[model samples]
Target: MQRELIDGVPVLWAETPGPLEATLVFGCGVRDETFRTLGVTHLVEHLAMSTLPRLHFDHNASVDLALTQFTCTGRPEQVADFLERVCSALCALPLERIEREAGVLEAEGSGVADPTTAELLSIRYGTAGVGLASFGGPGPDRIPVEAVQDTVARFFHAQNAALVLTGAPPAGLRLPLPAGERPARATGQPVRQAGPAWQQAQVPGPGLALSCDLNDQAVFLAVQLLRQRLTEAVRHREGLTYDVGGDVVFVAPGRGERTICMEAREGQEQRVTELLWQEALRLATEEAPEAELAEEVEAAREVLLDPRAVEYELMEAAAELVLGDAPMRGRARLDLIEKLTPARLREAFAAALGSALLVVPCDIEVRPRRADGTELPQFSCGQGGELPTVGESSARP
Candidate 1:
């Protein structure tokens, strides 16, 4: 990837055989908001895109867990115009449109993570940072203008943003966002339940979350192996599930939450939940077969060599810069995956299971156990303690 500075913002680009693609990425996202201010980043994205005039081009904006992006695909001039307008809008957001746009946001009530994944994050980090995903908080219509202003001031600026393109930077392209210092990186998240526990929520199926080093090749392969097992056991064999997938959520530099979510056939939630736990314990204990491990490695190889990897890698580089993670470009994940042994995979997975949180539907009843015969504890939102007498609390005198 080629790197340069455009109007004080770092620009990363590469050549690809397609329409020119340009993306403006900022460091702020849902993780930067409080419960009362949830969805504010998304609202800001909508507000910026609203300023653009109707044009026949592929352009849009989005906000995720750790970054906000405005992208466009077209001729170089069209792409340049779209980005210029977006940056101008950020410098002077039309606050009058907040109420109208809030209604639009309310009509489009969506979240970045699935319900199960969101609930697991809340269990892991309380109702802040990544945990805020589980909540809708105040209605968008109630989001104060002050919150939007503060978000832009803190995050939407030249110093806190990066741009990437599918080709070289267009001639005369500019990023006119206001000048501001980048905010401090978030680290050492507060934990609510750092454990091997289970909880019930309004989720479609069973899910599991494990905390581990984001760069751990063994854990990455273990997740892939577990997903494959769930697909075989719950979907192919029992016909109790339809979808098996997961996401690796970036929490801090070198740390993350790996989540696996399965969609079960109705009335078979219990069986699916049991199989999910069973497979997890089985992987944690037994060594994976050589054939199974080889299959995963081959899959990893395919992804690294695909044609679209260049664009993906550029986007990843911008995200790393925004999120304060060290550039992982030097480390070859595929090479590391090839060197992993079944015993190493089992050990890494077993270590991660020590910090696992499981989520099942509210109607499902379960008492899951670890491989060592100890049962995983159930999670509770409230502390278990007696309350003081109403208006007459006991005090030490």
Candidate 2:
């Protein structure tokens, strides 16, 4: 069913027909608070993300520059226990640099950690608007520890919180909310069809420069097709790696555009950058048989179905709503995947190519080269390691 009103925080609960693994996952997200507070939220999430390593259960949290998130997974009986603790942490964690927590916080924030593949990609993508240096966005070391503290002091609103329970929940286990009535828009989210955007991303990694080109609806579709094709060629066909995929998100929020990519065997570092680009180009320029599309779409469906395993199920459909109010469900997303007919897909690619943003996740320095193989070195990094440092990693201490 649908319910809302614990002093404004929206709560969504659903009972799906499936054997839940007796666990729950609650995700809390908030977009772009101060850089400092954002950092603190990261620290807070770390403080709570635990699963008794041995029990082999799942409990983790993440705070992105655009959003702060937390997820807890455990048996049904632990629902109340989990909820209480989570809420308590929400209410108690002091954003202030308390003397006791200082050592812990400093130690955590000071130590540096190797960049994840994703982090490497983020570093390459966070560029400025003028198409120049770092755009001061999230990257390997963009957000620092103080930024975490600053963000919480300013934006950590309780009402902005949400509690989602999927599996069997505790009887009457509700989030502690104030007395005022909740707004109507609180219960469910409204979804839109498309957004405005154009760009590409190049993530710095060792090997070939990997990039992502973004466009409108058509280009978005082409990107998805290219992702699947490459996954087939490099991953399944060549067994270079296990999985390979990318995303073309047509964000309608204030009309923004973004694309993401995943590769097999670290394709980002290969001299095969040209081949990868060619493959992406092919998705936009060439056409694939109907049978191939069918196979990949089926694979996509399987991915959509995997979440059924999580006891605390959050329909990705809904998350999209919260972020951008976009509905890619029912016939919408299906139509997107299906409508990328080879002929039409290429048209979409050509158009998007003009204003595309390329982000390749590799250490390969990008050299602008003409079709004739002439190298262009006009572009340069306005700065190096342009990320804000948050904290030192400590195995979750």
Candidate 3:
């Protein structure tokens, strides 16, 4: 990979097999907004794209949990034109278009994460920062014009942005975004449930979330191994689950949530939930075999070392730059993965499970347990299952 600067914005580029692809990434997304200004970042994204003329080439934009990306894949000139127009639109977004774009966004429907992961986040962080994923705060129509302007001024700027490309930077490519200092980000987010607890939520199936270091290779492998074990037990052996997967949500530097979500067949929600807990406890208590660890490590290497992953890797690097993280290259990461022993992976996973939050479907009742046979606490949003009347209630717009 090569690094350079364009109009004071950091640019990372590398050679890959594809039409020229470029992404302008900013270090802001749903996590940067509050309940009152929910969806403001996405509203900003829509307003910017609404200004572009319809073109035949592929171009689009998206806002995720912690980053917003404007991406295009076309000839060099086309890519350059797309980036320029996006930056220009962001700088001078037509306030007049806010109402129309709000309606458009309403039709589009906003969802930052899947239901299970969102519920886990809400359980972990309450109703602020990354926790807002589970909330649908006042609709897009409620996002104020002033909020949009302020969001753009604070986050959509050159210093908070990074550009990455599959090919060399296009000739004459310019990022003419407004200049501003990168805003301070939290190194450790406040926690609501530092828990080994279970709760009922509106999720498709049971999910487990463990707070851990995002960069920990052992925890990474543990998650992969857990997913594999669940798939083997819940899907193939029991035939109760249709899909089993996991996701990692970034909270701050070296801090994040590792979530395992499973979608079970109808009428098997409780069974799947029980099985999930059993497997999680087993993985936490028992050491994995060397063969299983090697299998997972090889699978990871195949995906990371594949040539087609170049663009994905570059986009990740750009996100790291925008989020104030030190980027790890594929080769370097593979080297770390190769050295992980089964004992180390098991130890890391066991430590992480100490802070596990389990969420099951609302209709299911469960009493999950830790490896030592102690029952996990049942989660409640308020004291004695009732809302607190002591705090002031603020009305929404």
Candidate 4:
């Protein structure tokens, strides 16, 4: 276990050989609540990836609102070479950090027709409840091009980076040390906007609408289990949807949400969303039936509490604490789950089910066409439209 400071920020690290699996894994460090940095860091990762000539494995980087991480998975023989290259890559990544005043990624939707596919895409997304509205992820609408440039620049700067290498520590590894130290950065959490912006946008009637968010140590486990069940039910059992699932955003400081979405086959979009919604409602409202609960709990245990004590599972726990601040770690979480009663999980589910809905959007990305066979330009729209805002009229709908 060698945790050090490169460019000044403290990075948590370790290396070990999966004597059983022969896998070599690595990770990166965090600068809290830098969501744009996450995308930027990933962009830099893609840009600098050209440097690793010796690497012959899967390489990727992930940045969230809480931390930025770069990782590589390789065979035992190439582990040492990969680490050295990574060390150099982090220091040399070309970033022209752009600091700008944050803008509401929304715009006054000009009644212009989108000309190109890119422009059409911009418009398609603009109407979705996505915009620079604080709950991150490229909204389903036109994003200011400058926001993309600004994030890319911030990712290249020196002061905000940390790298971790796992698997075996190379015996004769040579690491470059810089003379000018990196200064410490304060880690601030990203705040969600005043109200919930992450809601379902309405399209044609009877389409699916679903939302789910969970903050727990067993989140990944929950995701895996949830996906499995949903896939089996939606795709396999009833075959109601061709596509169905959500994102498990693993952010820091005990914060991460699970989102589930599904559009029906042909006219089933509404049907699928309703079914998907039931599952979210089900997870919260129903007690875990013996067989299902046992199966899910077991699945959760495997994913969240992998047998490998200090590998991916350990890293996630550390990420939860360092980034999110809650969830069990190391051996502690495993033990906790073993003692978890089915009743406990059921109650937890019920509480979440009854909670108030955060966002519920109408006018999802419908392909509203014009008389001249022209499509609308993708301008990021604000909260209101030519019609009144959401609450102003029960009369309008």
- C-alpha local distance difference test of each model: 0.89, 0.42, 0.88, 0.41
* Residue 383 displacement in candidate 4 (angstroms): 6.6
What does candidate 4's lDDT look like per residue over 1-397, in tens digits? 4565434433445555543122211222222213343233334444455566645466654443344445566564455466456557655643332222112112311211111211211222232212111333443132344544443344333333434455433455443423332233342222222211223333222221112334343333433445666778778988876654444433223343344444456655544544444565455445556676568667656765554555665355444433334555645665655565556665554443332122222433333222234542322345554854656434655
Cα deviation in Å at residue 111, candidate 1? 0.8
Q: Give the candidate order by descending lDDT.
A: 1, 3, 2, 4
lDDT of 1 by residue, 273-327 (tens): 9999999999999999999999998988888878788888898899887888753
**Cα lDDT for residue 131, model 3?**
91
Residues 1-397, candidate 2, lDDT per residue (tens digit)? 3544443445555565542222212222222332223234445555444322333345555543234455555565455555555555554455443433434545555311122223322343332111111222343134455665444444444434555556445566555422232211221111211111111334432211222232244555555567677667666676664554443222233333334344435643443344455575566556767776667666655654565533223444234433434434433555566556667767766555433334444355445343235542332344557566787766765
Task: Give the per-residue Cα lDDT of candidate 1 at 296.
Answer: 96
lDDT of 3 by residue, 81-190 (tens): 99999999999998899899889988988689878999899887878888999998999999999999999999999999999988899899888998998888655465
Number of clashes found in candidate 4:
28
| TM-score result, candidate 1 | 0.95
Stretches > 4 Å off in candidate 2: 17-38, 47-58, 74-77, 94-150, 167-169, 177-221, 235-270, 304-324, 359-378, 381-397
- Model number with the top TM-score: 1
TM-score of every candidate relative to the true structure:
0.95, 0.62, 0.95, 0.56
Best by lDDT: 1
lDDT of 4 at 62: 46
Provide the lDDT at 118 for model 3. Answer: 92
Lowest lDDT sum, 10 consecutive residues, model 4, at 109-118
TM-score for candidate 2, residues paired by index = 0.62
